[model samples]
Target: MTSERASPRRRDTWIVLAAALLARLAVVAWAASRFPPTADGTFYHRIAERVAAGLGYTWLWPDGVVTYAAHYPVGYPALLGGAYAIFGAHPGVAMTLNALLGALAAVAVHRLAARAAPPGAALAAGLLAALHPGLVAYTPALMSEGVTASLVACAAWAAAWVRDAVPLGARRTIAARTALLGVVVGLATLVRPQSLVFAPLFALLALAPLAGPRARRATLGFAALATACALAVCAPWTIRNCERMNRCALVSVNGGWNLLIGADPASTGAWSPIKVPDACREVWDEAGKDACFGRAATLYITEHPGAWLSLVPRKLAATFDYCGAAGWYLHESNGAACGDRCKLGLGVVETVYERGVLGLALLGLARASAESRARRIATRAVVGVGLVFLFLVHAWVAYAALVVAALFGGRTLLRGPVLPAAAVTVLGATLLTHAVFFGAGRYGLVTFPLLAGMAGLVLAGFRTRA
Candidate 1:
């Protein structure tokens, strides 16, 4: 009897997935050994412990009072809590989960890239995502980035599939896919409420007359059904917030805090401790303080429109500047254990990998923009030189590269093919969401998979053979 053999493309796909999983697991183990839970990790761990202990989602104060908290989104901690319940509350458990999620994220990126490119290109994209330093490094942290990244990529993929399925006239398939898209968006919003906007944003795109007047009504139906399903998924959480928090919070209560951090006169366009205004000094409750901060931030923004406007570039800078989330978080959590040299080395590795991929993505955008072969070559050469010069000029390369990529991605979303269009939509939403609140390297990790996919797509476009 002769055994059937797998095709080279199939083998390549498996290799990509295996490499992604192994890379993430190895990094998770290394990071687990080096860093202890700190900052947001501390909060997630403690909350998860409380959840595992059946204490609800309350934080035990220094005085031993148990007060329910919603300062952060409950999705990550609640998920962590479930894992702790099964495996015993441990940081390693969280890190392992993150590694698994990161692996799945790599798959999502590969699938997403495949929508617009060949199998070879898609596999390359998956490999890039699998080995991405930022994604792998962050696996050890008990943060929501892991969950958010995976969900965001899945959402983008699902949305793109829905877009693709529209022309097929498969009513049942469209409905099922639409519901799945809603579910993905709902889960994503639970982790990062800013993602709640995705449903409406995509729905608006669906509602557009681009498909002509005949398909317009069907697309409207799709949009409404998706919006309803998403709302249904999130309804329980919103109801819980209303009943328990005494305020109807859609997800978490940190929006005001984040907005205040980005809008205040003392704001540095990044994460910082929220300083209560005199008007909010008496507001001690989380919900109340959230409202107070919201009003205060609004006041500041209105009073100093120019100042608030100036912070936009700074916010983008903070969001995209040098990818070193893993190194920075580990260093901050336990620098004494890892030492400064190791931390710096990790930072250099992450930064170099980030810049390289980002530069290639920008070059891909440049190549795609030009019509003729000579023009494409000229554009690529010019962009290549400019990018290198920018890197040498200062750390501005990170900021510049990201900003340009985002702009080009936005343009692609408008006039490009469906697959790449969907990818850019996710990227645009992420950057725009953070632009309104604050920016941080960790927050941007949520989009690293998509970024890698974009770069992979570019590389594939240049490949002569599959």
Candidate 2:
């Protein structure tokens, strides 16, 4: 009898997922036509072309000099280069790879959700991932969003499996899980260096809760294993940078430049090169340029702490929503080359995904174990519809309400407060990083899986009890 019921729901879930994938493919095709590959896509493609020609991660300028790049990490270009080598240097090849990554990311979302939440919530999260506008917008591009999100999704899944699905007692089990997360994070950092921060954050979230001397020993072992694995993963690139560039850049040289951009007086606290000091621009080499920018940024922050403090709000606003006025750019601008209907469709999808689905998920995240099917359904529908509609009509109140509800709503269940706490921590950590450094919705996209896990687990009391 239980199998019969589960069989139908599983069938329905697949149907939704399949339809979502088809829709995403359609989106990718449409996007390819309307959007000529630009920005990071164009740069990545150039680097891939160079690499394919045995140039070894280089770029040829208009003046005809072959120069290597260190600002952007080489992992993404390497992926593109391999794809070009196999598929013959066509735009479609990379986009197709991106499409595959997007689909896999959706599947990872489902798996991660299942471990953290109930079946219904997992299904909902999967469907949402399939249709999310941000994922749709960037995944087709030759940018790092799809790849980074895919890797992060894998980490989230491993974290969930270790924490909620499997009991954690043995040091070996803990080390294995920590190492898995470290490898994923290290690979992601190769694509986007900032991802390195998550390795320590994830380790702490995973290992900090256990009690007693044995638990402490296991936690130490877990941290050591994770650190060793992450550093080992980064070793090749670090050595290459040290040898080839004669610098200590572990991942890339963009960090200092990015910080300078975010900290300058004329920067408006978002993304801007306008305030980068002239001396920094005079530096020709990547290492020298980064050093110049780092010095400039430090001087500014030291001299004018008030200015730095004020920029935090601007950074935050630009982080969540790209502040074009401050020149914080997005890969694809909203409604660019898209029709009114397309704009409306994208807007509605993004709004619903970020606020609506996410809001309900937060409100339901801490549900108690004993609940009837009718109550569960009611809770889901009422919370979801109400929050979504309010968010659509009035974003500020709805969003504030989301934060408040996530923090204060729902009854405590038998499960430890790990999931919710970790969700908050991940989101908080991402926000804090961007708020202090630079801000773009794209930059903070790592939080999506964490949010999905939290939301998918909401109101899952009936399934848990059963």
Best by lDDT: 1
Tens digit of per-residue lDDT, candidate 1, span 1-466: 1223225556666777899889988877776767779988999999999999998789899998888789999889998999999998989899998888888878777766665666778888889988988788778888898789888777777776776666677878878888888888888888888877777556544334245676767777877787777778889988888888878898899888889899966677788888878999988888889999999999998999998888876776777766577877788888886678867888788878877776766666665653456555654555565477447623334434444444433433343444344455666676677678888877778767877887787777742111
**What would you estimate as the lDDT of candidate 1?**
0.74
Q: Which candidate gets the maximum TM-score versus the true structure?
A: 1
Q: Summarize candidate 2's per-residue lDDT along 1-466 as a digit string, tens digits.
A: 2887567557646754685568667866765555555666788888888778778876678998866667788888888898988887876777777777777766766665554455676677676666666666555567776677677666655555556423536656766778887888788888877777667666655655566797767666666676677778989988888876657788888877788778866666556654657776677887778878888888888999998878886776665543121011122433466556654555555655667545644465325332455545554444454465454443323333334443333232223444444455556665667767877656656666555545556634422221
Residue clash pairs of candidate 2: 117-457, 319-440, 361-455, 364-458
**What TM-score does candidate 2 reach?**
0.81
As a whole number from 0 to 100, the lDDT of residue 68 in candidate 1 is 79
C-alpha lDDT values of all predictions = 0.74, 0.63
Q: Would you estimate the TM-scores of all the predictions? A: 0.89, 0.81
User: lDDT (0-100) at residue 38 of candidate 2?
Assistant: 64
At residue 46, give the lDDT of candidate 2. Answer: 85
